[model samples]
Target chain A: MKRLSEERTKLVFEKLTKYLGDNLKVLIDRPDGTYCFRERKDRVYYVSEKILSLASTVGSDHLVSLGTCFGKFTKSGKFRLHITALNYLAPHAQYKIWVKPSAEQQFLYGHHIAKSGLGRITENTPQYQGIVVFSMNDLPLGFGVTSKSTADCKHADPMSTICFHQADIGEYIRSEDTLL
Target chain B: MDVVNAILEKNVNSNKSISVHKDLELEIDEGTLLASDYNVFDKENLRSSQDTYLKNLTRDNVQVLINKIWMLQTERVDEAIVGILPKPVFVLPRARSVPKPKPLTKWQQFAKEKGITSKKKNKSKVTWDEELEKWIPKYGYKKAKADEQKEWLVEVNDPTKFTNGEDPFTASKTAKREKQAKNELQRLRNLAKAKNVKLPRVGIPSTEHFRDARQLAAATTIARASTASVGKFQSRLPKEKDAKDIASHVPGIKKKRKEAPLSVVQEKQRNKKLAESILRSKSTILHVDAPVPSTKSAKSSNSGGKKKSSKKEGKGAKKPKGGKGKRDLRSKVGGRKRR
Candidate 1:
């Protein structure tokens, strides 16, 4: 698959915006090591330790980078960002999000991995390819893309995100469905 | 010894018939005495019921013979004591008690006379009376005309279902009786009221409240005569409201009034009236035909000054000429003599 461009990411964001009505949040990690979050207009923004920790992982520099990225993606739509719950609660991101694609948008297979900020890291890494999937952690122990297209992108290193690939995503989604 | 076989059989009997009866009673005494010193009979005594000497002897006699043998050997009695004894005697077993017959009850006798044995159970059979439309007892109904049955068929089912539903039929009968009673009571009430006889109070606590024919007639008469009929027809009213409204409608019965609230002027006037009344009673009020003032005039009258002067004069009049001799009657009523 080709790298997700800014335009393509916007289309994905736009599709995800539908689910934002259904209480899902969207987030992105920038190359500068900072993070940005997306929210529904009706919902109040709450910065919990979890989002703060995720932002810490991207660092303040990456946060600024993610802000620019998100700004470019969401040209017209508005959203609020919150950095909640530092370190102790970053991995729960996948289950809390339920993205609704527009009737025309295809249901992206690895779209959920983006919520945990792993996709940003994996898409930028030289060793990654295709779409990276995130599981329970930001560590490289999980599965990720192993294609040259994803590796050669001009984005920051995505090794941390790529490690959490499809298998991890499958495990997390199975557990969540079981809980339901 | 010389004669030897002389005359041996000189006279051998001409003809002889021989019959032998064994009367056995063995008595052994081997010098050293012991109760079981020797054996007499090897087996149990033989038993016979008829009278051949052996037949005459019972098993008990045989047992006695064995005990004698032991006794003779152990006690060493004289031969004469042994010889005097006849054949052995044996034990006789105890007889069993006879069983008594049970007496039959009258019902059982009637059952039998009808050829109905206790062992034979009679099942109920119901026959349809076409004319009156009821199932009648099959056997009993045979004597009665089909047109005479007055009962109507309420239900019909298989014998099993019929027997199981006996209790429900009984319940229906009781409820029917109750409904009949209620209808009769309503009928009686209507007739009594039409004749202007009071309908006795239906739900009162006293026993007379029961609306029997006589009481109903009496109550109706009373109500018709008195204007008290205003509260009589309350069958349509809700119970609580009817009871409350009925009391008020009863004529010539006055409800007690609540105490009046007195205004300041009225209160002062009342006090003044009470004081004057109290003063007058002490003097002019005690005189015969004094004509007590009405409540209104008493309030305006000033009797206080005149009452005091009159009281002094009254005291002087009351004093006897021989002052201390007579007891004062007025003093007995209101003076120091009244405890």
Candidate 2:
């Protein structure tokens, strides 16, 4: 509901920059309505300025949720983007992977993506880069960090992890009832 | 209303009237108003019911304040009469302590050490100026006895030994200039002494080497504490000579830091507020031991939105619709690969 402080902004921006890269600027400063990141209950919400003002009118005790839940800070203060942030991350994501239909359910169930499940990967994708996982039809499902670069993937073991699951659409079904 | 009086009479059953304070200790400002009551508490009545006792006390104090305001002189302005409030009678604690006596100057310190007391040199401030034909201040504005301003002619006691037109006027001007320059230097030295800095013997400012060494030491210390990384993967070069005396001569980089643009501070404050707001919204009860790596246990914070409801299906975690058979099947995460 309020603006973020310098220390918290550093933490959130570092995590967000991992996935969005230079495009993180575009996500924060959009051509649409002005958007802001607000932290409530250790969770960061990316809401438009208008929604933030409205949400602020409600007392903190009664106010539950507003805008999109991007992620939450762990008790130790590390930021973790939730599955809800996939919408914002997908378009601006620098690295990407398409999953075969057979591996879609496994990703949704929070299992790491096996090399065989990777249908396609972006050219020259670097190892451990944050990437969006999509269906073969180009539907954004979840996001994760690439386990190996595109060149390494060609010779990687078929059963080895290609992408480590960070968040997925399944979370929209779990613990996300209050998410706007 | 008379209801309070009626209540007092009805509740008290005894004849003793409520004893209240005689003075109204009210302090009103541009918008803030404060009232302090010095009356003794009715402990007996408070033990039975605090509500009535405090209420009665407030009523009496308010009534006195109203009477005091009405007693003031009123002025007619617009539609209503307004009485200007007089200065408050109560003595208030000073907001700031009387500034401690200014740091002692060099002369004062010398006098103190020697047990010397100052005595006035002259009582009379004026002297007769023969040329001006009137009394003038010995040292102040418009002093007519200054040698440069007064000297008009010179007398030669021995005509052979003196130049005919020679006079003291020009010599006096140079003397005055030199005296003023000396005072200017002393003034700076006095100021430095008050600030607890020792100037070099030759000048009011510290020497070049002293200054450069102080700056180097501060820079070295700041650079070391500023970043925690061991220069990351790279090895550190030979350490620069530590400037030890800099701490005694100079304060920390506090003044340099304050010079940062105001926008930086505002941005920092905004981020801080956002962090606080996020912390405020999180449910505190559910926070337990750090599960760390996987933080995905999201229970609907709205109390009613319990996890694993049988009536819900696999539509999404937000609205679960599953059969009764999977109710207690185990695992916090839904369909998580559990063999």
Scored by TM-score, the top model is: 2
Model 1: number of backbone collisions: 42
Highest DockQ against the true fold, candidate: 2
Candidate 2 local lDDT, residue B283: 20
Clash count for each candidate, listed in order shown: 42, 21
Candidate 1 Cα misplacement greater than 4 A, ranges? A1-180, B1-135, B138-260, B278-339
Chain A of model 2 scored by TM-score = 0.94
- Stretch of 10 with least lDDT, candidate 2 chain B: B294-303
lDDT score at residue A80, model 2, on the 0-100 scale: 69
lDDT of 2 by residue, B1-339 (tens): 699998888878654343444654544331223456665677899999999888877777666666666777789999899988766665668999899998766778889999888586666888798887778788867763474466566454445644456444544466778988988877888898888788765744345644776675665554554545522333335875435545444333223233343342355355545444443332232132112222122211211232221121122222222222134545323223334
Residues B105-214, candidate 1: write the lDDT tens digits. 44555687888865647765876767656777665545344423343344544464455556645655677699889878766665665466875444644555735755
lDDT of 2 at A72: 75
Model 2 alpha-carbon drift over 4 Å, by segment:
A177-180, B1-339
Give the distance in Å from residue B331's predicted Cα in candidate 1 to where it truly belongs.
22
